[model samples]
Target: MTETITFNDLGLSEGVLAGLRAVGYETPSPIQAATIPLLLEGRDVVGLAQTGTGKTAAFALPVLSNLDPYETKRPQALVLAPTRELAIQVCEAFEKYAAQLPNIRVLPIYGGSAYGPQLTALKRGVHIVVGTPGRIMDHLDKGTLDLSELRFLVLDEADEMLSMGFAEDIETILATTPEEKQVALFSATMPRQIKALTGQYLRNPKEVQVKSKTATAANITQRYLMVSYPQKLDALTRILEVENFEAMIVFARTKSETDTLAEKLRARGYAAAAINGDIAQNQREKTVNQLKDGSLDILVATDVAARGLDVERISHVVNYDLPTDVESYVHRIGRTGRAGRSGDAISFVTPRERWLLKAIEKHTRSTPAEMQLPSVDEVNATRLNRFDEGITNVLAEKEKISFFRDVVAHYVSENDVPELEVAAALAAMLHGEEPLLLEPEPVRPQRQSRDRDDRNSERGERSNRAGAARTNDRGDGQPMASYKIQVGKRHKVEPRMIVGALANEGGLRRADFGNISIRPDFSVVELPADLPQEVFDALAQTRISGKLIELAPDRGAPNRRTGERFQDRPARKPRRKD
Candidate 1:
């Protein structure tokens, strides 16, 4: 029989070991067990593991063991993540694992943050630089970040970077790093592009694959609830009331939605905060730390903003809006079920999103079991039970409750009032003006049959939801109008870049987009006919892949679109970069 290998058996340094022990890491996960040794032995490694499977510690531990904390004059290691949140997460993990080494400093640099602090950190001499590829590339371009002394380069979530349109940036950054540096790349899946990257960049790397049943970890209990769009907030509030979750993240689709939902949750008495791309970097970090330290219990966030957000206290993840793709679903739910803890991934599926559910099931090869929405009676029962339990808990602490009990008894004796009446008055005072019970949902009339006109409208709605908006290609005669943008394949543009820009700036639902096709020097996308002038103007000014959309209706002639705002404007010479 073979014995299990622990983190102690992995030949880590005294400082790293002390730090791990402090963080309560008693054993190594499968990926860590396999990859840490190779990293410590000065070998490049390619690791395959899903999110939330301890991949950070796998490479971070070994890197910490090898680096000299006193050598903080320049960065000895660089960790690249696909998103700001992920970069922050990796940086935090490194800081936690290097707790015993006080001299070691790690700085996370990403877009949406001011350059002053990052520049100060760089000038102060950081030991480790964790940042997204775009920000790293910008620093490299500005001649601020030098990689000549870097000893280790870890590409965490390499596949996600490529999928998010960082292929060129990754290559450019890799070109700047010292050739003598050891590379450690981690990704959930190895597509052809990632394989090509490994072949070109890594030198005889040791590959380790941790097999799993699905893209998401098995520890996550995946479920879906059927609800209408208007009722989603109500359903989520009810779930929060009944669910025994310690901490949770509720994912919304847009920045506005995140803020609105967080505000609503706070109003409902949940300690909540909001995070999205539009938020400042400091505020985002503060919110995440609040969630970690138990000061906050709920974080409402957008998908991009919550990428790689890992908090051990998070026991549940609620998908308030469905992700655009299956991979996003996996990534969003992956925030929970981390380490060895169990978690719940609950998604709300509107009737029109049934196709998305099917796509998820087909991709994961596991169906999300349907979850029943908590009924009014169930919520009322839970409330009453909690009320009773609160009293019971207070009574158990006799020393604390004796004063209140005496005051109540004295009031009853002074007024010669019934004990029950005084108790009811006290309960009313405690409960305040909030209703003690929730009203049941109103029933809707069922449609027994459909006329031709009703059927046509239904078909149109289905087409909008199920067509190119979800599939990335327009169907023939889909009743959608086409618009053109100046950025395309030549500009290294991606379909999602267009979707995200329009959705965020124009506030258009994902279903509003029709067909999206990328061409050589330009790209075209389908949108609803006769869009409001304000929405068109907003989209025309939106930027994608660092280029102003300069959008124009794909009128048979190649005239200007720019939402008619730039129709008379002279065609300014195209920028070199764009």
Candidate 2:
């Protein structure tokens, strides 16, 4: 619970303590506290911890502390990670924690980028090299990376590496290293492959497992708002207007999205900036410093860029987009609710991502309470309250108000207006542009059915269909409406493709659809009668394989009696005038 701890307890060097302080690391995490001592004793270590548990420091601290700064840079430390993202993250951590050690240099090598920079870094001699297996193997074969003098070899996220099919590559890299090298393997889980590797490579390793705390912070309140994509931005703006957050971090999935969302927030008058992989390191540090110092109120960032970032002033964490993994969700929310401080985490879950939200709740073992979108009246009430507070504070302060009073008098006289009119004009000016807040569209909740037999019967009929043509009835014994898409059998579209696209874009559950009829020209999907507007809007925006829905009504024989056409009229051509 405390951030500061004695490095002597961890058996680390004074120089390492100095370096840690330089990087603002006041204490060690549970994993770091247990593994650092054993690693500094020159014994192999096996650490089991989840992501964002300070696993990097668990290994990096001891490895850096034990290394002789005067030793020749022949790659004394080698760290292997699963992906390019993880490799870069570990290398950055090493660089930050070792900032005070002038002789310490770290290099990250990974694919999907150029090899020129990596080759240059290796040739210049680095004290530590963190890389992915494939790229590290490539460097080894090129004779560009020399690990014969390696004193420490670390396999970060060993389970993920194995899952990514890097066992052979790992073996090759380990074979190239010195047999007497101290090895440390860390993973979230120890599958059989990882255990076998440990038995073969690590010699009498000290095992350290840090179990996750079962209880989250009670002071931290969690809630989620069900919203459609078009309404999420509006909902977020409304929340920010009402919530009294000191500083907040909004998490998005991609770099581009972070930038875009930050710009939108700034346009709405909130002090905001984007922090992503594309931003320079210095700029990222400056942005964070500004947020801490109260110059900025909102920071939009992707997960990778925001990792290991601890800011005590962060009062809220908004998940602008649901994370793809449960681990990511934990890390995102962990940014707030620190040091016994109460915080709030709000997630906007679209209908399609409801399953992911459920997964997160199950993984965290804490269900987030659902909330409705804030109404316009609520936002206005909050604004009015803030205005009254501002006036009260001004009255309480011992500041000069004669100048403001004179200006108001002058304005009233020049416009030949009443004092109240002058005040109203001032308020309108203060509100700035876009004063009318838009109301968010409502989202309907999923329906629950208790009839298992009827549900299974409908599912069986859907599964047994052999062709792309079928008319299906709902589990409730009602005929569903069917619509055809322009793309069909010739488009190489499968029933599952249609199903997934609909589920993802249309926010429709798998049960909402009765059957999929795929054909050469297009496909037909069955839906409940009188579908909600939100569902219809989502379908209109759905894109499958680079094609828009372009859906027209499917007036099959069943609907002929209703006088409905099978296809809607095409867009009218403008009068072909000269």
Candidate 3:
């Protein structure tokens, strides 16, 4: 077994040690254990670890051990992050670790905030500067940020920065910093570009990679619920009410969705908060702290905004919206099941997003078990149990209730009512107007049925056999309505792409679509006859090869005898397909 090391053994300065103790940190995490010694020696280092692996402290503690708070403040240390939220989070880590160290100033510079305050802070002199690449470049251009005397430079989530297309900006910033400044870089995945960056920027850096024991924590129980698009919000609410979770972080796709979901949860009496890119750094910090202290129970956040969020009490992670990619799904669920604690990861998979869900399963090498929404009666039972427990606690306080008991006695005597009736009236008064239970929702058809699998497999086989030109057959010997989409051979549109996009967009299985004939300008596809207006509308608005799927005008009826094919039409410039 590896030797256990604590914060005390890491050789942190007295001030940093005091701050770590204040934060209740005891032992060092795996990344911290391997990286602290290297960074403390002023050697350039590259750390490979995920978000919740305590990489921030792994870098921050050592940098603080070398930083001189009383020294000239021309930005002694610089940290660059991909997003504003991550930038603010790193800056806050510095502040917390430097709490006992006097005169140490750390400033977070990012876009979507006033430059006046950043300029003011810069003029006042700051020891460390943490910021996003784009905003940092803007400040560097204006000469508001000075990295001349910077002793340490750190890049948190370096791969993310490159994925966000900030490689050029990052290189420019690094070039401006003094070549002698100690550089430490951390990334979850080291792509070829990142390797090149390391070779160019880092000077024989000591590499530290602390691989997770498991792709997913063995303690986490993963499950998924399939619901229609319209009923997703209600499904989430029902799950939240019925599931016993101490704390949860609901992931949404956009900033506005996070706010909307949080508002709805709060209206339903949940202690919910929203964390996003638009929220101020101080407010975001306060919300996360509230979540940690048990003042808040649920936090709705986007992927970019929840980076470096490490809260021990997060018993559940609800994917209110499925992530766009498989890596994101893994990271979102990684927020929970941390520190060897058992946790739950629940995902809401809409019919249209089934492909994405399957992608997640394939990526993680584990399929989430199918879960059912709680019944109304079950939710009601939980509510009533909690209500009775609340009253029981009140009854235990008999001495404090003597005065109120007399008032109840007076009302009962004046109204000539039984004491039991008086107690019932009190219960009614306590219960608000809203019903204690919710209405039962219509049950949706299960997506994991054997019949659904057969349908998908059959569709895949038919598409494979049909090649590029095939007739529209609904598999039941019924004719399909042929439609033309604005992508074809020149655009590199394939039948699988068409099938996948249409099936996902229309919320239909692969078997629902028919043969696709690719032409020079456009392709002809056969879908179910008389498709629902809603499905048709969605298909029209959907893009196949970065071009909208448009309805082909009546080229007279499709020639059934010769099999449906697109007529000769003028081809446009070939557009690349993603």
Q: Which lDDT value does model 3 have at 333?
A: 89
User: Each candidate's root-mean-square deviation in Å?
Assistant: 12.0, 12.7, 13.0
Error of 1 at 504 (Å): 11
- Against the true structure, candidate 2 reaches a TM-score of 0.52
- Candidate 3 or 1, higher TM-score: 1
Query: Which candidate leads in TM-score?
Result: 1
Alpha-carbon error at 384 in model 1, in Å? 12
* Model 2 deviation from the true structure expressed as Cα RMSD, one decimal place: 12.7
In candidate 3, stretches whose alpha carbon ends up further than 4 angstroms from where it belongs are 1-3, 214-220, 223-238, 242-432, 435-578
lDDT assessment of candidate 3: 0.79
**Cα TM-score per model:** 0.57, 0.52, 0.50
Residue by residue across 1-578, what tens digits does model 2's lDDT show?
Answer: 85566665787778778877764566677888888889988999999987656788889989888887776658899999865556766887787678777678888886545678878877778888898776677677778888889999999988866654567678888877899999999988989998899999999998999975533456778899988778889889989988989999999877999999999998888999999878999999999999889999999999878988899999999999877556668878889988889899999887767756765675577889998877777888887788888878877765566678899998888988999988887777877765644454465544446686577877745432321123356668654666667778776677766775566545676677877788788887777654555555545634444355565445444335666533344422112222
lDDT of each: 0.81, 0.77, 0.79
- lDDT value for model 2: 0.77
Worst 10 residues of 3 by lDDT: 569-578
lDDT value, candidate 1, whole model = 0.81
Question: Against the true structure, whose lDDT is highest?
Answer: 1
